[model samples]
Target: MSYSYTIQQHVYSFPDLKSVLAKASPFRTGDALSGLAAESNMERVAAQFVLSEIALKDFLNEAFIPYEEDEVTRLIMDTHDNVAFQEISGFTVGGLRNWLLSHEVDSQKLAKIAKALTPEMVAAVSKLMRNQDLISVAQKCEVITQFRNTIGKKGHLSVRLQPNHPTDDLRGVAASIVDGLLYGSGDAVIGINPVTDSVDIVGDQLKMMDEIRQRFDIPTQICVLCHLTTSLELLDKSPVDLVFQSIGGTEKTNASFGINLSMLQEAYEGTLQLNRGTLGNNLMYFETGQGSSLSANAHWGVDQQTCETRAYAVARHFNPLLVNSVVGFIGPEYLYDGKQITRAGLEDHFCGKLMGLPMGMDVCYTNHAEADQDDMDNLLTLLGVAGCNFIMGVPGSDDVMLNYQSTSFHDALYVRKVLNKKPAPEFETWLHNMGILDDTGNRLTIEPSHRLLKNL
Candidate 1:
């Protein structure tokens, strides 16, 4: 249905739910580049106003992408928790926003209603939220997942030790891994985005990391960010803790990445059979970002942010251990500059957490983008305050292979110290035992002769 609202006799109209959502989104380069953003500030405000009055349940009745046309839509519709929705069944999107911000809705209330929320519903409500509103509400919701260690626990934050290398050199990759670990990072996982997708190379990397884990008896997992098929091919030969994939919101977008839901399901089931997890069996790591659908020409006119939330639905279905939004890495074409990038980062984190996925942020930007280290520091601190599950711990905030600037090992230390956060429980204990961190868990002890160094 077409939606319109009048302000001082000027009527602003949107042609459909999808159109309204696109127009209502906070100004970003992606929507504007796609010609889906509102034409004027007043029009944008009007769309947000109209969306607020739209009933929350109206989203349930309308599918942005027809269920028959999209499996993500079918997955959202067919598996939605109708029973849990009863709590807020009759509310409008604006009402849900107000209720979410009220004292009546605590962590438990958010968790209870989490499964009832659809990507569209969350995306619509997110449009009405300020950056602070996104952070505040997200801070109240908790989504914990476990593999070798638990993530997303309250009062604790985690970091994915992204020890990436330009070449698939075991010694070089292992060096970054050791550096990250020494700084009390990598509690989430020691993940490396390999230079190649070769199954043999990735298999060798996994074996090397696993050997390090075994030698140090570390309470963490290891992952080589390769294609799902490559990961599956080497599962028998290597120690794979988490299956990695770069998934998008639309089936076509996923297909562009050489992936489908069934492939993801098979990988999930295949990883589970390995029985490698000591803590829990959450066995997947999926990365998503805004504009991916548009980048792949598969958004079908939906806004990038909404398309991004749909990716969360896919992640939620498998109960993945971590869902990271590599925000700002998509370049200035989608996000434009630091301001837009910060907003998208906060919005993605909020939407993913509300969908009950363990969410992390790769607070990063490319060299050509109109961004710098200060912008990243700001986003990183805000994410810390938002209780983001984890972030990338890259070496010196630069990826020689990927050619991007991300949060560094020192960045993790700063956020943790400034936010008064600790690492995962098991990892915190390991740090203390290794004398890398004090018993109070406040600062790194920097033991020069640390035993883990000998393993190198």
Candidate 2:
């Protein structure tokens, strides 16, 4: 089917309501009513008008006419409830599109509901708009934002790489390594991590990554850098999956704190540009550190509450640009000084213990879970209930080495067992016979399998 217009670029360059109606169809008030009577039954046409939207919002910009939004909503509901339309056409996609083209839309409600758009939503919507493809430029952003909210469900398995690898090829190498190792076999989004604090380094990495993916035919993308959130320079360089930034450390006096704040500002500014810019999808991945000495007087380390406040502050400031984000919980043991803290403690703080404080942004648990298996289980279960969607850690040994070849399917199966409650039947039988499967045989009280721990 031929379309009247192709949104090859953005959606801003379209006609207005007065111009479109005048140019496309000469339907004045009396004339429109008369025409409706001539073409179809008045009742049917009126009912259809409530269900149909005008063709491509080209008419709105044409004559400087102000369309009242409430009218559009009332029309949508009316059409949806119309017995004739419902009985004749059921709420089909074509029916919805036709309704939207001829009717008005509540822009305010659309904005409120259009919060977290992601990449997957793109394909889904592209299918919806395949023929008409009439999504307004402004509406495209909102749709993408809602899409992000859906696909933003990530797991806590981050891929670590050497940021200061001293070569322009680092990004490509890192991308290939990550794609082969973590992303290749696992079902998680991979964050491209960097050690050095340079945008140029990140840019090179991204470039190399693109080249590697193109050359090797890998269908994967490394969400931008997981480093100190600084500068739009990195975002400006490439379309990213996410923008993971670090909140300054514990001590306010440390030099890293000063640098981190600077990075935070840059990241915030870049995120603003991204949200408003009709480019590809983007996100703000945030975290706070109590690594060594406290770098800031903020808290011992940036707790979830602090993370939520900061995230809200950024989201509020950026408005639409701050696509879905996560408040990373990087406790001391995972960073530099302290030994391993129990995963239960981290979950109580990060994943939340049924309080439901941080409701929106995804919560990413760091590789710190590798410190203990019971804690890993606790963190995983808590994350499941709390609705967190991202996870990070290295494969093979949890170090920054790309070792896909070395990944054990056995270990992968064990993780499946824990995550899906599909414990091996034989093992459960043994545990149950030994009185470990609970009285109902539905709950298995297996000691956190120490076998996996031994391998680690």
Candidate 3:
């Protein structure tokens, strides 16, 4: 009455084994078996018998463990080169389920290898592993890192132009401003805020690069930063001089964490295709908002670690893939209130653990967010040594830019003579007297030039 054998608590019969084999069959390959030769009943049975015998021998050899005195060894030796049965030898009915679920086996190959595995193995493999999309994630990481590096190193100055300006005129002004600054000593590439003026950010950047190639001959590349919309659009139109997207607002929403990241990935993918040469050679800046909190030092502050974590995760996730540059713009933890913020407080926010490596994502001091002089000083002092490559701000006077540079360089002569004085001497005077300084100067005042710097 009991026509089955029980092994390891499961009943097995000829019919049961056939049903299990049918289930373990390879995933449907659409049309691989359409043209088998038409034959009579006895001929078909004979062909099937030959195939089954060959497969059975292989299955016994691969699926069964070898012993000093074993029939399976003899079977494998007999069916040595049979492709269909080869895989059968590798799996056993009892262990089939476990092997199927293991990393060693792929779901797609199940049916092909079933001859070697028992019904139990096929059932187990089918139930265990799910499809993973790691390849896409890894591609995204590589793209992000490439963009970041391009924008990070070549960028020296940060600019914010009114969105309405004509592209040609804007480029000239940008060129002039940058040329003027270069006349002195610093290699400043303008950083622009694109969110405030989308068109100006995108249009002028393309125009400026075109003009630079046409009008002037600067040996090195000039860089600028733009908002997301402009960046995405410009990435399509021309080579991005440099582009950065602010990650989040003061609040934590799905838009900041999820949507923007998707947008970044999309643009990055497109940029890779559109870019002719190496895209990673340019820098991709990550200009983050002020950390969400009352304290300037908290990584996420009010926004909490969720915001910083997301940001750091993006950088950490991408850094391994990008070949060129990655820079992080970190804002201070507190709102600017004149001289209330301290250097130590600045350090906590500026030097605190945020994400990625310091060299990978350089910090940008943004307490200057309100353009407070003291806050600017605090940011420079605390974050400068911590490997901050850029200072985002508007220059009130040439003196301010000069002061920032002097502080950055820790120029002993300029510090002792100029910043350490009762009334700050004219920047030109300090330059003239200090043999290391250059005499060339620009007539940048607080009205227009300062306005350009303010929005940045």
Candidate 4:
């Protein structure tokens, strides 16, 4: 029998219902699970199964019975047991805070305790502690700060060439890349978000990016921000260095983008099967934003910022190479104007960092919104100080296709100069070798290069 589910306007079909059901069972809790359940007509009842809104046996009886015991279910049961152990350990919130402050409890112990406590319990403790103290503890948690090799090994920064054009024109894309490279960007990846959703168009763009990378010998990855399934389909036929998707806070919101955790996992695993990425490199790249959940009516009454952080939890599961919070992209309904946008950007950066994501900020705003480059500059400076992993390098911070202004290639240079940071090691070598940057990493005069000038 065929099973299909619709959430928002997207419909997901399960050709093999039992296999799909079993694969989804492990993630049958948390926002990711709830969001999937809510969108799935076949497993709509599974929405309540999260947090024991319904009993497991009852859920199985109402839903389909699994042939095998789910390891994820067993892990959940084990975590509950651990939570019970922590409750009786006699550490009050104040006591825990004091202990953390005094360094009497190390990060490992704190991490263990954090795992045992519910998210609410942690939030209550967080309320009583200083922000600096919380940040310090967060840094210590192993799960919160992952170092992936795609961008930098560790202690190095990166940037992506987001050369968005209105029509996915190869010349337009190359012009942006040339501009970005001349200004010393493209350490993370030279990725493009094709305006058209046509898989063929996206595939052609990916091929073009690959040809450029090979021709220039630039040490960077490439991505075309198509739907995850579309990207998966093109994996064998194209040079897809990373699988990209935009995920959000709620199931319905994610559905609006035609994404779910299962689909994300499929894309990630498919990339692995192809061995397309560098050895020991992560394959997934995701973009997220505040207000996306509320925009899609999937906020579940939660505040936009908290819901945004919950999206990080989903990102953490996949160990993506890059998880960027497009902080100001959603617009005024959730974050009204520049002040709100700046605050949300900083908060999202902090929250994503604490959750151990290779966090980047889009540092962007739409023309229709009450924002400008000055507002983005303020946030960009702060994020640089906060050790952001990457940022977008578009021409003049303007996306001709998306019609939004973001950080420009010059802006990236400014931030790196101010922070005394360099690009990824490989890309840095390429820049020096090309004479675009000198031995001291200073930008050389591009005017002498007629080829680049001619393009300009």
TM-score of each: 0.98, 0.40, 0.41, 0.73
Superior by lDDT: candidate 3 or candidate 4: 4
Model 4 residue 222 CA deviation in Å: 0.4
Q: Highest TM-score, which number?
A: 1
lDDT of 4: 0.64
lDDT of 3 by residue, 125-232 (tens): 321212221111111111112322222221122112111222434644454444333323222233433334465555756665545433533222234455556667
The lDDT, on a scale of 0 to 1, for candidate 3 is: 0.32
Between the candidate structures 1 and 2, which one is better when assessed by TM-score? 1
Consecutive 10-residue window with the lowest summed lDDT within model 2:
115-124
Report, for every candidate in turn, its global Cα lDDT versus the true structure.
0.92, 0.32, 0.32, 0.64
RMSD of each: 1.0, 21.2, 23.0, 11.3
Tell me the deviation in Å of residue 413 in model 4.
Answer: 1.0
- Give the poorly placed runs of model 4, Cα more than 4 Å off: 1-155, 447-456
* Candidate 1: tens digits of C-alpha lDDT, residues 1-456: 888999999999888898989999989989998999999999999999999999988898889998898988999999889999999989999999999999889899999999999999999999999999999999999999999898999889999998888887889998998888888899988998988889889988999999988998999999999999999998887898999999998888899999999999999999999999998999899999999999999999999999999999999999899899999999999998999999999999999999888999999999888999999999999999999999999999999889999999899988888888999999999988887888655556565677877748
Kindly report which residue stretches of model 3 are placed more than 4 angstroms away from their true locations once superposed. Answer: 1-172, 183-189, 194-201, 213-225, 249-258, 274-282, 292-306, 320-354, 357-375, 397-456
- TM-score leaderboard ranking: 1, 4, 3, 2
Candidate 4's displacement at residue 124, Å, is 6.8
Residue 49 CA displacement from its true place in model 1, Å: 0.9
